[model samples]
Target: MHQLLSRTFKPTFLKIYNESHLHNQKLGRETHFRVVIVSHEFNTISPVKRERLVHKSLEHELQAGVHALSVIARAVDEPLDTHTSPPCQKPVV
Candidate 1:
């Protein structure tokens, strides 16, 4: 996933967190993710457009059972938010 996003975005800074453990799904499943992407490509784009671009780039993964994705896309000049996803309320089995 990280490689794919890197190829697609060419971001200056990128972080991909696999939050699958925070879910109740089967162990080792790569279902949930949070990605922070900083790239010049996003400079003049609207927030919705940035998200759409990221989503479009990961279309294949989403189809292959990526259940949830949280994205924070920013231009190179924008401030980054490093926070990750909230803890899951559901108990892991």
Candidate 2:
């Protein structure tokens, strides 16, 4: 999956988190992911577009088995800010 994203976006820095442990999943299984992608491709792009680009790149994996993907796509020139999300409200099915 990292290979796919790297090839597609050519990110300067990419970090992928397997966050299945935060839900009802076994260790080492892939069902939820958080992606921190920094790339020149996102320069000046809107948040929605960044998400769209990422989603498009991971379309196959999302369809195959990845239940959730929390994307934090950033531009190389963008300012750094702490990103936080509310805990999962719905129980993992």
Candidate 3:
């Protein structure tokens, strides 16, 4: 997942949190993630567009069993936030 985002965004700062454990998935599965990506590529883009770009870049992984992706996309000039993913509310089916 990191590799995919890196390739597409060329981010100056990137943090990926494997939050699958927060959800009711198999113990070791890499199914959910929170990605904080800071890149010059995001300059002038709206927040929604930045997220769409991240989603577009991860299309393959999304189709291949990545259950959820929470993206925090930022322009290089923007201040970083102490953002974290919220715990999953949906229970195991």
1-93 in candidate 3: lDDT tens per residue? 789889888999999988999988889999999999999999999989999999999999999999899999999999989487777798659
Which residue pairs show backbone clashes in model 2? none
lDDT of 1 by residue, 1-93 (tens): 789889988999999888898887777889999989999999999989999999999999999999999999999988887886788896559
How high is the CA lDDT of each candidate model? 0.90, 0.87, 0.91
TM-score of each: 0.89, 0.86, 0.91
Clashes of each: 0, 0, 0
> lDDT at 30 for candidate 2?
96
lDDT of 2 by residue, 1-93 (tens): 899999998999898888887776899889998888999989989989998989999999999999999899889988755365456667559
- Local error of candidate 2 at residue 4 (angstroms): 0.8
lDDT of 3: 0.91
Best by TM-score: 3
The residue ranges of model 1 lying beyond 4 angstroms of the native Cα positions read 91-93
Q: Is candidate 1 or candidate 2 better by TM-score?
A: 1
Compute the lDDT of residue 69 as modeled in candidate 3. Answer: 91
Ranking by lDDT: 3, 1, 2
